[model samples]
Target chain A: MRKQKRGKRTAQEKANARKNITKAIWRHRELYLFMLPAIIVLLIFSYGPMYGLVMAFQDVKIGVPILQNKFVGLRHFNRFFSSMWFGVTVRNTVLISLLMHIVCWPVPLFLALLLHNCVNTKLKKTAQNFSYLPHLLSVVIVVNIVRLLCDGQSGLINILLREFGKDSISFFGDPKWVYPMFVLSGIWQNAGYDAIIYLGALSAVSEELEDAARIDGAGKLKCIWHIQIPCILPTIVILLILNMGQMFVIGADKMLLLQTDLNIARSEIIDTYVYKTGIGGSQYGFASAVGIFQNIINLGLVVLTNRIAKRLTDVSLF
Target chain B: MKRISGERAVNMVIDVLLVLVAIVSIYPIWYVLIASVSSPMEIAAGRVLFWPKGLNLAAYRKLFEMPQIWMGYKNSILYTSGAVLLDLAVMVPCGFAMAQRTLPGRKFLNTMFVITMYFSGGMIPKFLIVNAMGMLNSPLAFIIPGCVNVYNLILLRNYFESSIPESLLDAARVDGASFTRFFAMIALPLATPIIAIIALFSITTHWNAYLGAQLYLYDPKLFTLQQVINNILSRTSSMLREDISIEELTRITLETNLQKYAVVIVACIPLVIAYPFVQRYFVKGVMVGAVKG
Candidate 1:
């Protein structure tokens, strides 16, 4: 590396920085006034709750504020660890995250790539628009559809199963299939819509570059593998890092709707566990502890992934 | 541009696969709408496939009769519009100010914004804060906590930074335009695309959201459409266990399926109407971010 430039600024440069302070203040006061509402809202909703994360370290109750409570360092975390839910919650969170990365993450990319490769523009646009429709459906609505089509009585899939001379699978009732149900539905809902990013990346890759590859005698698969995927790897990495950051955040409402006594074995993940313990169980501190633990891991994963992506690809969230 | 003329066999295979994928992708939605309007007896027999056998608005009529469903609709519209209004008022100027390099306290405030994106206090803490603020059981709980989406803020900030040229600001200043005048006159006009994008997101998000309503509001009447739909779905089975004979109950059960589809269909009508516009702007917004990213 070259020599550092610390303390090396010229007198003119230093003066340039200080020249317009009063002027900038007067010129930008209206802008500052404009932003104050947003700043205050963030301070309240975002930062205030962040300060309330201290409940994780306190013996706190509802109605009573967190600071009013006694400090109980690691008591909740210790209890969480000792409890049986630690294993179940952690296992479910990780399993879902892995399934998302391994199964769902690639789907949009594949769809995007396939669409990008297609010559028919109308078909491509139609498929693209059609794909985002499911995402627009509310989770409740989607889960309702899942219940309908996955029902043992008159589910379309089970009807088809009987026609094919096979057993109709109980998707919601079975513990093993519930996770797949979550992941596959996720893929189904998001793949087409999320593929927009990859399509954007594909569009950004120059037609000239592909032509060059083709002129050099590369086949269709070869062009995609060597050129297209390579061009979009930064985008893929960025998206992957984002997906990884939310590893523990399997959504709560969907799980609650989907959970049966039969499949609670798989659906009782960290979020649901926290919700039940906090609101239903009225163990605020313990719930907060569980929440704080998962979030800390999430924060660490996000930061770690950001750093790795930054180092390897010269792209990062920040 | 030289279009690659791959093998005829390859092209045919790709076309066939694409058609299949599109069908599979849209088939469920098709099924839902068809089943809702289809002959109920035929649906129960699993004979209603690909299209409605006896098309009718009976389920829709039943849905309209339920005053609770209408209340859910009223609540949904109130929340969606209210939240979007608050969101725009907060985010536009906030994002614009953040985009200004010379804005005082920019670095500190930007740090505040970015940190919140990564490390939010968990839901319990958020609930406590909201409870402390007495935003609970009020429309404010839904509207206020989620008013300024940080991700949308980032997108808007990036848009302001890039699309609204520094030269334009300088020209406005030369014309004796104050910062507020410049924003209202110059920036706002150019920022329509960003506004549309964020608006689309806000509408869809607030419309589809159930978890927030679940956490914040307790009153059944205050429940949004998703929560209303959820209650309907969960109750369908229990509703089937009336003391009537098994045959009569089975018929009711099948009718209840139509009810579920009708509720969902009713809830989704706004989305179905708005999605064409949303699809265009949303894709455009993401593409804008992709280029920047």
Candidate 2:
């Protein structure tokens, strides 16, 4: 059997394999040297932490080696599964993320198409500058800006509201207004920046196609619906799939910053919950269990969404 | 008379709407700018609108008076520049090496880099690792743990392969140049565009990061501009929530509305100034990174 397998391999193939293995080493030695420090950094920081994930099953603490702790199977998992905060957190995260993703996804695409057809290039460039400006600011700055503008007493919006004989809205402090503020900030900070990818795709679209549609007696809106939408549909679908992959991955940092005690009911998310329990409370195993649970769900959603997109639109991340 | 086509009419309407949005988009920054110099009493009473009620330098003066803000700026500048250098040092070579088809197991290394982007050990494990290594509370904690972003690495890798011609590399090899010599002398010079783009990204990320400072740094001296801004914002909002009487407003709170706005602007000044310059490169970098990878 071994002789038969060996006989199947041509002499040229054997020699090429040897060359690939042996000659590549000396020739690419410097390349390997270049990659060495980075590889070592990744091994220590990225890969090492992944290995350290095993502490989810162990009752471990910082300053001690993770392996020293006794592994109690499913204990942390059981605590998380039955915890009171679990359902609240998952529901809040899904509700907020789903609403933001669906609502905010198409604004950029719409804006890009509109901007592309705009007659005044100067105005278009000026608008582009304004739109993407917020993307550069950190979440804290954005939230603070929102706070200043939407402040119930001195805020510009409330001042305008009071002028019209309407009650001032408590945007940051009230539980009801939290979601609106979150979604609005999402649109403001991201919509203009997010539109660039679609803009890139849209700018590449052939003018001939649009002209042909117009020649066919189609109006502006009709041409957009028929020609423009379908042309960028693949990019749209691919982006949608990518967005779905991150469905469970809520913004822990932003949420933590935006959370007020008054709006805590609506604000708490899975990532924040984990951060509190794991780092804040020092319940390492419990936090890791929650983190693992979340990551697994995110992975499943991404794979499932990718498969669906592949079937429906013939576009997928993979 | 030239006739206006229905298409032209529709385009006009879209233009009007886009202009309105552009105004809304830019107004937040502009509003804060005018509000920061307005009298505190006017701001607190919701009287300041469209422009400053009275031109005053009190808020900006008060903000500068706080020594902590200066310290925050100093620390942030050091951390941002340091982190940028480290990021470029590690990520560029790694990206170049990973892109080289001549390297053994390039595919495997690429996959290894990409996987980290999707799946990580989450915050706790990473924190534990950082803490165990005694990097907690240290500037190295911020610089070392996140020196290389996998997405940026992948983007750089893609750029290297797509932009750098293979024949140029071959010519260098034909001249009997070692890989390091060729990379340093020729490749590095040609790779300036990507290096600039990555450096900008590194500067933005390191400068803006606050959660790290919140979690890791116990010493007040090590706090970044973002952390100090966060504290200022939180304290101001809580004070606003209390809603003191007009007579008490002057004495009840130390943070004037002008000071609050002034401080926000101060925290954002460095980044805001740099943003427009790099905006074009930023868009290109993001588009390539997003669409391809």
lDDT scores of the candidates, listed in order = 0.83, 0.82
Please report, as a residue range, the 10-residue window in candidate 1 chain A with the lowest summed lDDT: A1-10
Residue pairs that clash (backbone atoms under 3 angstroms), model 2: none
lDDT of 2 by residue, B186-246 (tens): 8788889888889988988888897877778878899888888878766753435456676
Best by lDDT: 1
Listed for every candidate in order, the interface RMSD values in angstroms are 2.0, 1.8
User: What TM-score would every model get versus the actual structure?
Assistant: 0.93, 0.93
Give the Cα error of residue B191 in candidate 1, in Å.
Answer: 0.9
Where model 1 places Cα greater than 4 Å from the true spot, the runs are A1-23, B1-6, B239-242
Pairs that collide in candidate 1 are none
Q: Tell me the TM-score of chain B in each candidate.
A: 0.93, 0.91
